[model samples]
Target: MATHFEHLHAVSASQAYKATFASHEHTPSSSIKVQCPIEVSFSDDTQTQLAYFLRLLKQASQQSRWVTFIGHEALVDKNLLQSAGIDLNKVLVVCNKKGHSVQELMIQALQSGNSSAVIVTGDILDFTSGAIRDAAILSESFAFVINRQAKQQMTIH
Candidate 1:
């Protein structure tokens, strides 16, 4: 099971890179920015989804760059992440409660050139597709947005 999960992670990482690079050919005069948006569908198995996300983060960090997560404080589990072999020191969590708009924080993180990938969840109305593309072009990192409300079903039956 673990091997299968690892294989899936590897495949996902490869696909992300391919999609990111395939979209842009000519090298920008400034820096390399890869736009990779990973969407997490809402499900009863939040832990499973979280584990998969952590795996993605670990893969991104393998490039020796930091991973910045901007979202609600309850969305990330430090203990679970540490258990997954991710270095807490390399992870930066910016809570949405800090009074800054989540979108603003995301933009700052992407443009700061300090993170390899920025994972954003919750309240992403400010992150328009054009804005994300522009940010990716201006920074040296990848951006992933988690759709926490995706696949929501009203009927319990």
Candidate 2:
């Protein structure tokens, strides 16, 4: 199954894995999990998607959970998230490219064992199935934004 963001033209992390799988033409023998962008970016929107994300984070923070942010876009997201009343330190920003970033950041986050949620760019192929599985296993909750090419690759896989 696909995610809501896919329909909205927003990127999801699973899309990256799907792209990797399709590029290899590997038959998907395992299931994948991905979460869509809670808010989409738009130049004309009355409010910024980032603002919405912040609002969500503020609400989520009432529960007092640690949140992690992954991806280049996450840099901006983290900044906005902090503005919405989340502790700036509570949000972790990942700076690596997809193929290399996910595994490393995931490992660090999992090892830290303090993160309550994660927001990452869609780069599924960056991590082995095992690593992805591990993240799925380890994170209490996670959000992924799948990029456009990921699904095309997945179908090819």
* Winner by TM-score: 1
Model 2 CA deviation exceeding 4 Å by range: 1-39, 45-48, 77-79, 97-113, 122-138, 144-157
Tens digits of per-residue lDDT for model 1 on 79-152? 86778777778887777667886767877788777887787765334354555555654665656666656425
Model 1, residue 97: C-alpha shift (Å):
7.2
lDDT of each: 0.56, 0.45
In Å, residue 118's CA in model 1 sits off its true spot by 1.4
lDDT per residue for candidate 2 within 59-90, as digits (tens), equals 33444556666665544444546667877766
| Each prediction's TM-score versus the true structure | 0.59, 0.44
Error of 1 at 19 (Å): 5.4
